[model samples]
Target: MSRTELLRLVFAQIFLHATMTGLRLAAPLLALSKGYSAGAVGALIALFALSQIFLAIPAGKYADHHGVRRPMGFAVLAAAVALVLATAFPTIPVLCLGAMLTGAAAGITVIVLQRHIGRAATSNAQRKQFFSWLAIAPAISNFIGPFGAGLIIDHAGQASGDLLAYRICFAVLAVLPLLTWLLVMRVRELPFEPYDPKAAPTHAWDLLKSANFRYILFVNWLQSASWDIHSFLVPILGYERGLSASTIGTILGAFALAAALIRMALPVIAARYSEKRVIAASCIITVGVFAIYPMVSHAAEMVVCAIVLGASLGCVQPMVMSLLTQVTPAHRQGEALGIRLMFINASSFLMPMVAGSFGALIGVGAVFWVVASIVAVGTPVVGKIQLRDNEMPPEKNL
Candidate 1:
């Protein structure tokens, strides 16, 4: 594909992801407006991740067998329908259902897109650069989606409950996926190459059984959990601190903006440090950031934390993608990406519910401390990651 074609695909992914981020930030506040407790809100978040956990591998398999075009089209359309559902119902149950549909759609779309990019790249350098650029779309979308949602909610005076402002947000979000669907239609479809039965690794479990791949998956899970917790807890934390919806959205947006800025510089950073070292350092910094996140009561303080956290976490995705593609066979890239997502989404599915309960009983502050402890404990595991070959070039003086 030409660079223009790739960019168009990336833009569609951006819109779809923005919709997901907007919903993620808005859902809890919407539920809270309806008098739901923290625990119930957590369940709502779990429902989203739960659906992805179940469908991820299957979605990957479909992509591997049928190619990405059809799956991408379906996923975007499903997301559009999901946003419309949430807009129409404006209830906790319906919103939960919408979350599931959105998650499933996102899971499929992500694996397919990653596989598409992995296949298109001609070298490790290009792969790193491509995936880093790919990561930026979501980072940018994360900023636009949540920040926009918060602005809409605050301006429309609908932060309190099931109100017109929230519905309007959903309505606007629905347009993004529809546009993605149109873009997917315009892109030339790649021909599908059926998975060869004679291939060494026929099953997803076979890849999971490899010690190196398992370690990568575990590291991904830890990072994924941290991402989930930050998204899930920050809004609630902001609400508790008496921050407005707009301020909370901007804080989250700042985090995402920092992430985007770091991602754009990842190629330069990878030139200086090994992907393994970068990832390990990021986890350690993340532990420190989480330790301080709970204590901050002011919006400005939270934005500072968000920037630090975003920069640290932002270094992770491109490295992981670079490493994952290096470790896995070319033909099975789709399945491997799917399995990786399954592990992450499984954590996403479980952690929010646990955190929610803890938040309900103990406090949201305790939740942050627990997340910090978990990341700290996992740092050594990140240190142990031994890729068979270093994909990045040796450090060069700037």
Candidate 2:
């Protein structure tokens, strides 16, 4: 595929991912307004991750057989349906269903698009650059989605559980996927050899048997857990420090901005360092961030922590993608990506509950300390990831 085509795909992904992020932010607040308990709200969030966990591998396999565009089209349609369901019904059951649909759509979109990028690149340098560019979409969308939803919700009057504003947010989100669907239709498909059923299929479990891949998967999980914890805990910590909602939002926004900036510079950084070394350094820095998070009493200090944490966490995804693609066979890239998603979705699904419970039982500071301890333990393992000498080709600009 041409660079122009790859960029179009990236833009589509940004919109689709933004829609999912907006819905995730809007769903729980909407649920609470409808008299749902905190547990119920958490369940609504988990439902999305659960759907992704179950659908990820199958969707990857399907994309491997068919093509990325077909799955991409289906994912956008599903996201559109999800937003419509939320807007039209505005009830708990409908919202729950919509969340599940959106989650599945996001999971399918990610696996296929990732596979497409992996296949489109002919060399490791291109893969690193492409994946680095691709990772920025989610970072950018994470900020756009929640901030936009909040602005709409505030304007619509959130004081009385104003349903109109929430619906408006969903309506806006609905249009994004529709636009993406149209874009997907116009973009030319990248060349991929269709999967032949006559050939034996590879099982996901078999992929886990490789020690290097297994280690890479473990590192990916840790990185994902770090992201989830940072997002989940920052607001609570800020609130405890008596920061207003807007201030807390700014802190998180700064983190996201730092992530995007770092991703933009990742290719240059990767050019000078090995993926293992970069990832290991990130893990170490993340450990420090968590350890310092508990001690930050001022909003400015929180922003500082956020920037460091975000930059460190931002280095993880593309490196993991680069390493995973290098270790896996070309024919099974989709499946490998699927397994990676399954692990990530599963972590995302379960970690919030665990973090919340730990916070409740041991206090928020203890939660951060625990996460820091875990990362500290894993630092050596991250440093020890062994790849073949040829895994990373010489760096070149795209």
Pick the lDDT winner.
2
Model 2 scores a TM of 0.89
> For residues 1-398, what per-residue lDDT tens digits would candidate 1 score against the true structure?
67787888788788888888888888889999889999899788777678888888888878877776788878887888888998898888889888888878877878988888877777766777777777777777867888888887887765554488889888988898887787777776555567677855567777766566777787877787887889889999999999999999899888878888998898688766767888899988899999999888899999999999989988898889878877776656778888888888778667777788989998999999988998888788866656645352121200
Q: Where does model 2 exceed 4 Å of error?
A: 153-167, 186-199, 239-244, 360-362, 389-398
lDDT of 2 by residue, 23-118 (tens): 999999988887889989988988878898888888877887777678888898899998998889889998889888888988888888888887
> Which lDDT value does model 2 have at 131?
86
Query: Against the true structure, what is each candidate's TM-score?
Result: 0.78, 0.89
Please, what is the whole-model Cα lDDT of each candidate in the order they appear? 0.81, 0.84
Residue 362 miss distance in model 1 (angstroms)? 9.8
The lowest-lDDT stretch of 10 consecutive residues in candidate 1 is 389-398
Count of clashes, each model: 0, 0
